[model samples]
Target: MLATPSDFDVLIVGAGISGIGMAAHLEMMCPRRSYAIVERRDQIGGTWDLFRYPGIRSDSDMHTLGFVFEPWRHEKSIADGPSILEYLNRIADERGIRPHIRFGYKVVSADFRPDEARWHVTVELADGERKLLTANFIYLGAGYYDYDDPYDAGFDFSEFEGDVIHPQFWPKDYDYTGKKVVVVGSGATAVTIVPSMADKAAHVTMLQRTPTWMFSRPAKDAIANFLRKVLPEKVAYAITRFKNITMQDFSFKAARNKPEKVKQALHKRIEKALGKDYDKEAFTPPYNPWEQRLCLVPDNDLFEAMKSGRASVVTGNIAKFEKDGVRLTSGELLPADIIVTATGLKLAIAGKIKISVAGEPVDFSQRYYYKGCMFSNLPNLAVVFGYLNASWTLRADINSEFVCRVLNHMEATGTNLATPVLTAEAEAKIEDDDLFDFSSGYIQRGKHIMPKSAKDYPWRLNQEYVFDRKVLRQGDVDDGLLSFTRAGANAMMAEEQLEAAE
Candidate 1:
């Protein structure tokens, strides 16, 4: 059943931002060690390449999102998708990581062999051929969302004989110039699509089950623009990053502290923009602000679209699809030539790879996350996941740095194995109240895999840089779950006691 395998020191899954970042770090730190990046797609730039919705851009500014070593020279804070993809490609080229990338390679499964002390990975190539790769360690930089479209809930699309499209699979040759379009969902993608598509489409209608809190702000930072004119690109990037992060964090707190007052102010602004046409109650969301994400509109583009009569928001659940339109639950049918399903993404944890050790399944659902990097009982594996509040790359960069430190530590200690160990008592000390309570698919799926820590010590993500610096960056590399074994111990342990070996 086994075949000859290629070998490497490290094997990274996914060639997206995280994987590229990891590759950059690994190449810099461990040049002597061999590594390869396996990407399923023919090209890189994971989410950016996957999402083709009109006007799609970063929800957060590109400064902090960009790599620290490789400064992003984009003039706009919220850069477009093509620009971001280009930046990733540039980074990969600049760092010489492209040659090591195995494009059109998808890893099907991985198992940690206790006897061999290596991961036996089964990867399916673009051709119908399969191959194996043995590596000392595995890093899952695989993105969190599912690849297939999410709006496959068996909605009655046959009744509506008009064109229907999902953003994930947006057709390049689609002609929506003169057609009346109805876009469904209220996420960032929907917010972005409405404004851009409205500029061309005959009329655009935004259909939503619930309203998202929309905040309109300048797409380009005035100060950053001025800085770019005078200061160097790196200097401008740094200052703008600092300014954007401060403002975003402050806005997050502002919404949390004075929710009702802020909501009232936002409501007033919407009313002021729409005049008498603004239905006061129709645009309101039930939950506290940011409990679900707040949608950002660049330079009031969506608002301007609505004001210009190019776009209008319709708040109601879809009753069903009619012959030439969508019938809402509120006894109203909206005529449309095209319908765009902007439904939320389906989240797949660690890209849904089944990881097992010693022929026993590693119950990832039962495992707890440690520093959001490695899981309990999963050895020689590190995941680069970021914070929910800050830029994903910020946390990813830190995780990269931490991983380098860990590798360095392990190398210095002359050890080849390490994993987080959560004892029953340690796990029992965690409180459920301290965790993120959102019901989004991403959050809910993560809750099962993430660590539950008391607000103090090893279990908390305080959102403070200083605390993480001390806990994660400068923290002890050996806090117990990780055990080191030489060549002989692995074989002897497998022969004797496999369950307790780790």
Candidate 2:
């Protein structure tokens, strides 16, 4: 039997950007709705607080990464982890969202009761106590990657006499000064760490099996800064956000439609940054631009570090780990005093929380994603999985607003349950598509666990931010796909009829 009297109207998992955004939206749109945010960590910022490595910053510009309701007033568009954390904290305090967040509480599992039209959520408290809380709806914003485990590249670190560190778990006050540091992998983490560590390390070498496309832009946005000086803060922010979103969308579409042209443009920028005589193989990727996310180098910092003889890039397969350093397949020995495995992340679905409906476990791989937020046949639950090609908060903002619309619709219609029901006949007619079309290692590894997708909107997680913004914001909530029903409506009606006969 389920607990009586629901604890909250909505239970938001993870106090990350997505979770906070949802809460903020509820305050503005659904003022009377009671909601709570549960976060495993003891802090407010999710990724910003977790990652403490040097030069840890946002790959995307802050205008887009920031919440739509808040303005990013920092001079630098590419913000550091601390500054981003500060922004989130400010939003929480100003909006009174911090009071609603219960830190150090991890959601263990959630089971939806069809009869009650609510979810019985099980959470593990900080002191290892399991608590039960029931809510009318569940919103998961726990992020995509596993917080406890990172993607293991399966490297033999026995022979290495130096300290081995993964960026996910950076040691506090780690002294790499005057030490030869080697950072493995070629993604954003490696690019950011190499240049930042080069300032103190004797030398920093980035080792990668394959090269990744790199793009450089100034940390500060000149136009955005200029607009801020002349216009009001909110107006300026709105204009800047719109501009960045348009440019991002255009670039992604261009890369997809005209690969060769985009590739040439990217190569030209790299050639200009590193000089024409630089090693093309070290900077060139086999795939076209945006095939994987392009590493953003602020103010050509990585290139400057290379030019200063403090940092370098080496592309080769690792043969083994030597006593002093790593051995390459090409019979090259890169001596190092410290090794930083700047590897990728281990992706997880729904924060790895066990979900069930009517006593049956939910297999997300078999269920279809309904409009990128809710799942098919899953009632009163929504998960925020951000965009791959653009800023994460862009999707988060839309999804939060969409959820608000859903809640308001339910109240107006006097319905207790909202489920996106996909009939067997309709499911048979739809074709399956890759949930995430990207070739990133994490995406490929986590594909089997992800929800199924189709070729069209309302069935798949749409990549186009502009398109999603319009559809999610202006779209109808009572679309025939979503079936709404009141809990115990028939029994109540029958009782009323019997009373009338007497």
- Best model number under lDDT: 2
Residue 310 error, candidate 2, Å? 0.5
Segments in model 1 whose C-alpha atoms lie over 4 Å from true places: 1-6, 149-151, 268-277, 433-435, 441-457, 460-466, 480-502
- Give the TM-score comparing model 1 with the true structure, all chains together: 0.91
State the lDDT at 353 in candidate 1.
74
Q: Which predicted model would earn the best TM-score?
A: 2
Q: What is the lDDT of residue 222 in candidate 1?
A: 82
> lDDT of all the models against the reference?
0.77, 0.91
Q: Give the TM-score of candidate 2.
A: 0.97
Candidate 2 achieves a global lDDT of 0.91
For residue 295, model 1's alpha carbon misses the true position, in angstroms, by 1.0
Encode model 2's per-residue lDDT on 1-502: one tens digit a residue.
3446799999999888999999999999999999999999999888888999999999999999999999999999999999999999999999999999999889999998877989989999889999999999999999999999999999999999999999999999999999999999999999999999999999999999889988899999999999999999999999999999999999999999998898888878878888998898898888888889989999999999999999999999999989899999999999999999988999999999999987789999988888889998788999999989999999999999999999999999888788787777778888988778778788899899999999977888888888889989998998987777777875354233323322
The Cα error of candidate 2 at residue 4, in Å, is 2.9
**What does candidate 1's lDDT look like per residue over 237-295, in tens digits?**
77877787677677677878989987987787777667766777666887777666677
- Give candidates' CA RMSD values in order: 3.2, 4.2
